[model samples]
Target: MNLKKTLAVTATAIGLGMSIITPAHASTGEENQESPDACMKSQSASVFKYAIYFNSNYGGAYRNVGYPVYDFADERVGGSPQAGTQPLLFCHGGSGNNQGIKNNAASVRNKHSTYYAVTYYNSGYKGSSDWATPNSSRNLSQAYNQNASFNWSSL
Candidate 1:
């Protein structure tokens, strides 16, 4: 083939290959590149519905968001009690401090659409624990009342 014709054929082939490949990947609905947290946020508008109310039965100070709240010292929503008096506190893998909501949470609420949160009595997810289901709110029982750390899992 002439130089112009050969170049045109090559370009057309490349274009067609890209078009076919692109659609194949797009149609699979598996091109997700978001992090797990981001994915959870997108899957449920209620993901951000999570909050820890200070008072019982979803009352008092509250923290509402998809991300785990490790500390309540900075949160003063609705004149929330001091860290130690706050109704709730969340902790991840690391061991949380003894003071503050570590052992003073009065209530817990999980508004996630597909995940359940596990609260522990001691920091670092050690000691006793209680699992809070999604879209649910309840007062911390006497045993798990003073929770320290917590983590969540998909349902």
Candidate 2:
């Protein structure tokens, strides 16, 4: 092929390859680059959902879980997408300190700019639920201490 054609073909191939390799969040057009947080690469978000608290009114034993979890029992915390996660833990002072987050959260703050933070009462996002709008917070009514799963929703 001619020089111009060769360059064009190579560029096209690289672009196509990038689509597969780029993290999902980076490809969403929200930002041009992947987050620096290691665990963010696989599912890809610049930040964690929000503060899920062990007390009502958004107090005590809070964690910034960086991704939606099927169950808090899944001992994993924010880290490299390639590196395995350690158990999720409270970062500071609180009544529930030293305890795991599974079925323990009572209130939450939603920090995502694009999605509502939804917490469920059963595993796999089933059963009763409560939600906090982006940048908002509220104590769970139905789920309460029974919380089991979590996910984000655009609606």
RMSD of each: 17.9, 11.0
Q: Give residue 42's lDDT in candidate 1 (0 to 100).
A: 31
Candidate 2, backbone clash total:
1
Which residues of candidate 1, in runs, are more than 4 Å off?
1-49, 69-99, 142-144
lDDT of 2 by residue, 39-139 (tens): 23222243555567889997776666555565565433332233543334454565988677767889987877777888899876678999888889899
TM-score of each: 0.46, 0.63
For candidate 2, the lDDT comes to 0.61
Which run of 10 residues does model 1 get worst, by summed lDDT? 24-33
Candidate 2, position 118, lDDT: 81
